[model samples]
Target: MFNKMSIINKGILTHSFKNINRNFNKNPEIAYTIREKIPSPLYITTPIFYVNAEPHLGHLYSMLLCDIRNRWELLSGKQSYFTTGTDEHGFKVQIASIEKGYDNPKKFVDELSLTFKNLADAANVKYDRFIRTTDSDHYDTVKFFWNLLLKKKYIYKGEHSGWYSISDETFYPENAIEEKINIQTQRKMMLSKETGKEVTFEKEINYYFKLSEFYKDILKILEKKHDFIIPRSRQDELISELKKMGKLDDLSISRPSSRLQWGIPVPNDPSQTIYVWFDALLSYLTGAAYPSKKFKSKWPAIHLIGKDIIRFHCIYWIGFLKAANITLPQQVIIHGHWLSNGIKMSKSIGNVVDPIDIIKYYGIDPVRFFLSETSVLEHDGDFTEERLFDSREKLISKYSNLLMRSCGSNFDIQRALERYGKMNLSRIKMEEFPLFDKSVIEEIKQLQDELNQLAKNIGKSMENFNLHSVTNNFIRILSRSNNLFQLCEPWKLGELREHQDLVIYLSTETVRILSITMQHVIPELSNAVLDRLKVVRTRRTIEFARVGADEAYGASANRGGDHPITRITKRTSSYPDITIKHQKAS
Candidate 1:
């Protein structure tokens, strides 16, 4: 329900205060002439979750990835639009509702979708729009798209007889099916090797799209845009799969209304409804307000989807867009699945990891961090409490603890400064201070240089959507800062007065830089750290200038510094019943 303004314009912080030290003006603003200058909007989206069950780790992982990208865009001074929602039109949803004795599918989906919405809110997945395939606007949008494809002579009526998987809502070729017996039911059935779902021979008169026509063109796109798929391995897999197919089959775009009546109906065909996948994919366009001004710039979005659905997103999605004369997505990022301790999650096995329960037990930030940092985008990741705890322990021991201690020491220094009088040590030589080591100053200079290099690398990694590297770089800088603070022994140099000022300045400034750069991943902790330091600035920009004597002394002298929050709350501390650390120790 977020307004466009909130989604696109709210998070980019504007620096309110003037530069304290007027001497630093290395980069100046440029005056612009009207030449149709419009900043390209950053459009980020996740594949909407199917509303057949409660939100799980897989859903949360996708949402977290999108949220992280949107946050980085905001930090980079881009107008970002992030959309996530539920895919409500599917046979599974209809069956679940009926079997649960619900009188109406709408009522059932409405209540269930709210749980997802609530979970999103609880996890701080701030999306621009929570689009549902069942929305009135979406129905019109899907119908319009279908008609356009028909007008282009791409859609046609055809009788399809094939092995269909009701669970996957997909038709499998004969070679793709394997005969298997249900373990519990002990009945012979045909299963799809790709999806591990039972398939049956079904015949139906359905509407189909000429997906075969786009094979060569899709190959050309893949050849030209090497980065169309995030990891090269996935792209190669897609190309290999496509090449092996030889020729594409015309994809069925609708199901008989008698079989699936809960979806958007084909225009002028009450006897047929749009296929669930087709109906769901168009949610992106509807959420972007397609065929309108808003759609013009953001037509092609960056789609973050799971690797399992790569065929639907990369292949079928592209064909639809090309037929409609719409620009294809800028990029498609395919992430791997989350295995529960190396085992595939299944309801029958009772191994599905509930994300909400993780949030409730260990707090929200830990869950977000674990999923994003631990997973390898190209392969499956094992989600274990032990891994989560280890990640938490590292973040706390290295980053959070450093921030708290630095701020605490700075507070003490500020208190002492207020009790005595103002001290400006801008022009004083490092060696002039009592008991000051020249090596420490050299080390600080080296740290400044390292920060500059790391800042650039982090920016590049983010542009490439290398979040794991971005996070690793940030942590490296933090670990360096912590090392510097420990080596300098800032607290022990309190009696040296000038030496104490130097140590406090270096340590607190390191914390300040971390507070600014780490804001995208950990907003709450960053805000608290920034509050204590009183070093407010625009989030759009990152500067790594060496702290000059004047700037450091001025920040220390300012009364704006105050104790904001004394300590950061750990995710594990609140949930004593949850043994996130015990497993790690074992």
Candidate 2:
């Protein structure tokens, strides 16, 4: 029911607003670009990952969500810029490199950053820019941003004191820090209630951003935009917290370079280094060609990030943008972390999952499919081999088997498609149906109605960025198609002659829709499916994902039991079981 514009464009922030600071550029330019460049390529981003550790399942899940949204935009005849890379500069990475016996932090980050890049390649996460904090342009941008903030009086030298967690690389308020006993040492220690990481009271003179100035501004934006953050509940959580506190503390934006020597130094002060988060967040802008004369990217990309990083993004990043007069991002999406077999992933637990190994064992599409099928925003999703195996099997049995049965060995699908695929059976009266049983005709009508519903539902889902609902819509239609296929017994319908065409027409129509709609989630497999169905490339976009979108395509759809989705073979690679996390202790 959606037009192409409706499917591809989530219009600018629906509310208009005056800037809290009269000097700030604010949303007016953001709105101008959104309106003027309506046909421009969409922009999407994933949080530049921290490089203290190797890539894990949680990292892949974040990429999967970004890739899905980007692919959806692309398939709908829109261009999309996708950016993802490493957050290489941080106290965590500095200490981690020292622990790993690396003398040069650059070498350490270089090696780890490639591992993330390689993981993206292996997982088929097609990123446009792999921006790194260490990149030359990023260095310029960070310095430029720093000077701009200083010029605006948003930066001031101050003594910052708080409960600091080296592991988390952030400060926590007094109320957020609590004493807890270290289980292994059986010793009492202060831990951050927010992250459960041990925190030590640290006080130092550093550069602080006047973050408190923008507390009300951010609260106003959240209230006005209403949908600025994805998965509404999280946005509501932030709004509630913002309203309850009604104030924010000035944020420390730098550290003494003697203590943290591996980061970007402040604009004029070499003795001080910019905060890791302050430097890292600029990767998005740098990747988008920010502050350039030839600014090709429209402002306000949709940023996909993990829930753990929401506070930093909503509070610090927003404050910095407001101060620097940069356009605020259109939206931010927070996804829940992936648990290893229902246990939280932790290095101490030895439960961290290396996603590339799984991708190598099962191939990219299955892993992509599994992640897309699991809804992460509601809560943490548990990734077990059994769960993966189950999801893989259900897809194979329900969709692949259906494809094999309807288009391959069990029926004369080609003949049926040739005869009836172009006809709109819904427009014909009930009396015109060629059927042996009245239920068969009714079933055909039901399948046709469901196919129409599939189109409407997917458009709505994609428009609203409800990713899980898209897959659910596909599964529902696939199930109904399977049921209709079973009732008609198209394999047996051939000799009966009249009933065969109707059965094949209805079932293959459903398969065609499934193939088209599912292309965004499982691209490689969907390509293979479309190839097997003989569907031409041009018709593979979203517009053609209808019941009878192609009649000329199924001339060669007879692959017997062979379907791309039916790849349930024993994996040739021996993937380490990540689910053993809780059972095996470090």
Candidate 3:
């Protein structure tokens, strides 16, 4: 019998993929298991966002996924590289530019690309490189990559005919197209069944990549690495699709320059411009300073992308790399689109959530916490004004409230850290602290052990590329610690110095460790937490997240320990609420 499993994250139902029935224990190892530290010289990336549309929550989420992974490596004291930028070449960008009446598409892409960069800055995305396809270096790289493929005889001129999507910037197989009726105009149209976007018949001569020849090579990568294409549903989709087609058709790699003049020209052949997908995919190499020694030393990158373009990234990109003899990316982490108010965001419905507007309405770190905490890694997530409001309350009430309690005037967190924080777990003798009641010591030890275990749970989840588990783990630890603090009543233990000291030390240590872990998601607020507790700037890496890791800290002058979470209400937000006019025709 097929077991119906509902995989959930933070209460978001993630097992929503249809027709994905599986037997019990078919793929058991996908469970979250503790793993070793991710090796150094790490690279992480988000797909270059296509400039056809203005920035949305979907785009912001992708950038956040990259930043979370990138910052984790940074916090762990490893050398890391991260890259995210705009995909400025393509039919979609060309049409959008003309519709806006811009005579030069470069001028058009220039404006859109800056918006993405600004958004990344506002979201605290510490990207090492922000490459634009129009960059001269990128143009050169795409040309060189194309010439290498041509020299390898993996590319050839051919006549191509298929249904094409301007929105998707790729051609669709015949089985993927569907006939649909326009809701408003009652007009019949052909649309990509996968994307629900309009597709038109196209016939042209273009350069083709032998994508079919690398089908087995790509499949072997998926089969070899079970967690390679994460969120098993996406992996199953590709595997099922591959099994359906023994081998894929050769992919068209160019468009006539006369028809699409806004892209990189084919090497030595100006009449045919390289396909935008090919040009855009080359941004990854260019973003990393490709062909330079600087790019070669890192491990394969971890790519974060939205599920809409999985085919391009997984099929075309993997095939291209296989042919080029380049190592495949460490993994392709796929996420689903965000819906607005229980409905898929649509311009016609006037319900698209402007990320900047939300950022202005809510503080940045809270927004980060909300996205990272509530995001369903495997399936679509719904975003509503109420949910955002609730998430902010959670940060302040549950987490910040605990901070105020543990570090308030009633307890000296600095004194607690200085007294007992230096003792290593293995070196400590439990019988030495006999002045306090054995039960009080026992509870304090339990909390300390629980606090220590939080890092293990969080690390394992993060190692598996599950940010939802990481953020939720933070919330769970804080909530439990808060409950224990209330029960222990450290305030009433006036004569029992050892009892009070142990309780306060473990509690404050919880906040310190939490602050370091939270830095991966909420930057400013986590920094604020550390600053309020007087945690030194140099002692905030992942190494200092344990009990005895930093004994010398917690003695500095306290800064903002009074209310602790006033950063949300008091600080001036860096983003504006200005909404961009939707350019799509109604």
Worst 10 residues of 2 by lDDT: 14-23
Candidate 3 colliding pairs: none
TM-score of each: 0.83, 0.89, 0.86
Q: Where does candidate 1 have its weakest 10-residue lDDT segment? A: 27-36
What C-alpha root-mean-square deviation, in Å, does candidate 1 show against the real structure? 9.4
Candidate models: Cα lDDT each: 0.72, 0.77, 0.76
TM-score, cand. 1 vs. native: 0.83
Predicted structure 2: lDDT:
0.77
In terms of TM-score, the best-performing candidate is: 2
Q: Write model 2 residue lDDT over 1-586, tens digit each, in one string.
A: 1133453343421121121122125522232232333454667889999999888888888887888888887877777788899999978888999999999989999999999899888988887788998999999878877887787789999888999999988888787789988889999999988788999999998999999999989999888998788888999999998887768988888999989999999987999999998998888788776655223334567888998989988888999888876778889888898877677777775667679877776678888887877865868887776667777786788887777776755566677777777787766555664554676676677778777677567767765556678777777778878887787676776566557777777777777778888777888877787777788888887777777777777765775536676555654323345545536755
> 429, model 1: CA deviation in Å?
8.9
Q: Is candidate 1 or candidate 2 better by lDDT?
A: 2
Per-residue accuracy of model 1 over 1-586 as CA lDDT, tens digit each: 1244443333321111122112113211110101112344778889988988888888888888888778877765567889999999878888999998988899889988898898888788888889988788888889878887887799999999999988999887777789988778999988998888988899999999999999988877987899999887899988988888877788998999998988888899999988999999999899877644345445568999998888899889999888876778889998889887676777765667878887776667666767767757878878776677777666677766775566552445454334322333333466575465776666766766665455566667766667788667667777887887788777786566666655566565666666566666666666676665555454314563224311322243334444332323434321232234436655
